[model samples]
Target: MFNGKFLTPCFKSKQPWKRLLSTQPSVVLAMSGGVDSSVSAALLKQQGYKVQGVYMRNWDSLDEVGHCTSKADWEDVQKVCSILDIECSQVDFVKEYWNNVFEKTLTDYAQGVTPNPDIGCNSFIKFGSLLDKIPEGTWFATGHYCRTNNGKLLRGLERNKDQSYYLSTVPEAALRRTLFPLGEIESKVKVKQLATDFGLLDIAKKKESMGICFVGQKRKFASFLQEYIDQPPGPVIDLDSGKVIGQHEGLYGYTIGQASRICHGSHKWFVADKLLDQNKLVCVAGSNHPALFSDTLVAKNWTWIHHQIPTLPVQVDAQVRYRQSPEKAILSQTPDGQYALRFTHPIRAIARGQQVVVWDQDWCLGGGVIDAVL
Candidate 1:
């Protein structure tokens, strides 16, 4: 179920995209065997576009006893392609995923930041390596829930399912040639209904994927990180009283603003901050603890959709994570070219290494990694 989910902390784009579709342009569709991609492929083929399905075999082994769902997903991909009467091919990108996404993710975790691997997968793997497999001059399409307006990226029809945040890192060039057949669709339920109406019942019934992409949906993030990053127990300290309250599995095992597993009986504790150098997790008694909110945040690795960063102090709405409602903010460029977002209200747990995508109304202006909070 590889759509636009797994991502890493740092990424940059170099590809330039131009869309020169012929009367019957050939399209290489990333078919993840899910209903979204299946419906996308079917729709593209029906639209008189030459469509071919590409199933990426991304992760073969994950730490000796670990494996991914690529095998099962490939079976579904083949079935959909067969049903659609489109030629399907497989590409092995295990090495590419390991190098570009997984390694950076582990490094970010080690640095005490909860990074988005889905962003890295979209930037480096889907839009980067996969471009190499596609024949030159062919259009690349995906099932992502976003639209492009004359090369400018825009929100999908369904705001709840919009994926422009995960795709903020894709180079403008590649995006110019990208096709999102399901972009205008209103809802996931509607997409599934379309699939069933198109005779793709199995695809419509497939469960939507969650969590990490290559890793199974049920895999615990802490358990997964334990496999790569050392699982040293660290002290969980109360931020209010500066007292050692409990123990954490590891500093990297926690993310800011998330509920603490170290139960506080009747009271609740939320991770407020991580002291990486000291290997300590700071927890606050409540979810709305003052320590959990920040009005200002500094971000790095800025990548604009159209390669344009508006003048400093530009008013825009920003999102620290997917599915989060965009918050009004003043966007400015630090002297170092990093972005500074001063939200109208303090946001809860703006974690370093998470991408903060800025939007002008419905258009995604750009995105960057949160580097600091003020």
Candidate 2:
């Protein structure tokens, strides 16, 4: 199944993989049949590492229209591995994903909180169960756009695509054993170009995957979630006037800072908060409503990359969401033992259950879940 022409581009000195030494470490790369992971396998193989591709099936349920991409994705993985001449395998993690990530995510959503399943999947599945399934001495690798140095997670060189935030919850032990081949690449454009040069043009042209895998792009999130969550409709109230302006399918359908689709008025309305106890969806009149921003928030269950909490009241750059510009903030411990992140300037939509990743410049110190927005 090997293509001699496909292997030629990987050896070019100008390729980003050229920086890697010929260490030949045994590596198990998480291949997702996307351009990123496919390129990761190629880079690892080119670096002289003994690489094996493993496709993880995390979600098994079919979409509302009775469709799933797992089969197609596996086909792509096989094609990519064939071109690279590497042994490829598949593993099912559906049970583990449900127990560790999806279950907790649904629970959070049911309570009007927005939990980030990607962070949980990285910590529990990708670096957790997947690591256990691999050979004992094999180094784990993935297509994540983040860097590591001396066991510390760092931002990807491509700032816009930096995924250090999503990986903040991963343990230091996992960080040490993980390899990120795409970390040093200048941009996603370069990655696609590299894929084409590597003779995997079909995979290179694939659209980037987004959102939760189980929720497939074809279905509405609310509709997909309705199947799993018994979301009773609730009132969408205006924060300023305290008026019941519209009705919402459920609190899970809205997140802090999102525009209120159900509300209609001369001015656009944004979700300001969710009064979970009262089962209310609060809205503000304008997109830039003062109620939509907050300067302080509390984050609990903090995961420090070094496994040690830093000095209290430490100043760091923090991000409440992925791809957001980092903001200057102070992280200090609260009386309740939770960490409080106070931004120098007000940040918009600091939602509960969302991750707040902190960075010491480019080094990802770690992160925690948003417990309270103040």
Q: Highest lDDT: give the candidate number.
A: 2
lDDT value, residue 152 of candidate 2: 92
User: What lDDT tens digits, residue by residue, belong to model 2 across residues 216-257?
Assistant: 867677777787888788898988888899998878888889
Give the TM-score of each candidate.
0.91, 0.92
How much is the lDDT of residue 281 in candidate 1?
Answer: 90
Error of 1 at 72 (Å): 0.9
**Model 1: residues with Cα > 4 Å off, grouped in runs:** 1-23, 62-67
lDDT string, candidate 1, 1-374, tens digits: 12222222111211212223457788888878789999999999999987777777778765333456677788888788777777766777888999999999999999888799999999998899887556666889999999998778899998899999999988778888899998999998899999998889988998887756655566777877787788589898998789998899988888899998887657799999999888889999888889899999999998988867577789998999996999999999889888899999989888999999988998898799999999
The TM-score leader among the candidates is 2
Clash pairs detected, candidate 1: 5-118, 6-117, 6-118, 7-116, 7-117, 7-118, 7-119, 7-120, 16-173, 17-173
- Specify the poorest-scoring 10-residue window by lDDT in model 2: 1-10
In model 1, what is the error at residue 166, expressed in angstroms? 0.6
